[model samples]
Target: MNEVVHTSPTIGSNVEEIVFVIVVVDSTDRERISVTREELYKMLSHEDLKKAGLLVFANKQDVKECMSVAEISQYLKLTSLKDHQWHIQACCALTGEGLCQGLEWMMSRLKSR
Candidate 1:
């Protein structure tokens, strides 16, 4: 893959190539759902990350009040991201569940590229 360097004044002279982005959201935090969705939209819309794969971890799946992966995906407007490849995984950080599946999906995408 060709290097897609990113430059930021905050980290001056330290450029890194970005191939993909991972966003972890708290599924049990109902109040912050909108905020999380908005932030994700902003990131997906960024010009610098146009070609990057997006992996969203809908965490805290073990919580009874947590949102399901489908609900989170709908609220995040993931369908609008037609130009990029993305996936959302329901996970329980405490139990280490679904984490490997998420990473494996990411690796598959990278290998395909």
Candidate 2:
């Protein structure tokens, strides 16, 4: 399993080849989501990573006030990533809901590539 664990907003410029990038965000926090969008754009804009696949996981769906996938997508301005292949999935880590679906989606996209 190829994976890149990012612990900071400043992604390394040394990234060589990336198969897929999973961006996990808290659906209940609007401010964090916005920050995440900025970071995502910065990371994806790197010349070496432009073709990498992206999967945005809007987690914490179990929370009553959490944003839906559509809302998260809208706030993230995902449409701006028209040149990249991306998908947003609603998920709840507590119950493992939507986790497999998101992974499956990523796998399918990877296989197609």
Candidate of highest lDDT: 1
Who wins the TM-score comparison? 1
lDDT of 2 at 107: 84
Assess the local accuracy of residue 91 in candidate 2 as a C-alpha lDDT between 0 and 100.
92
lDDT of 2 by residue, 51-107 (tens): 878899889999998888999999889888876889998898999999999999988
| CA-lDDT, candidates in order | 0.89, 0.86
Point out the worst 10-residue segment of candidate 2 by lDDT. 10-19
- Candidate 1 to native Cα RMSD, angstroms: 10.0
Q: Once superposed on the true structure, which residue ranges of model 2 sit more than 4 Å away at CA?
A: 1-18
Candidate 1 weakest lDDT stretch, 10 residues: 9-18
Which residue pairs in model 1 clash with each other?
none
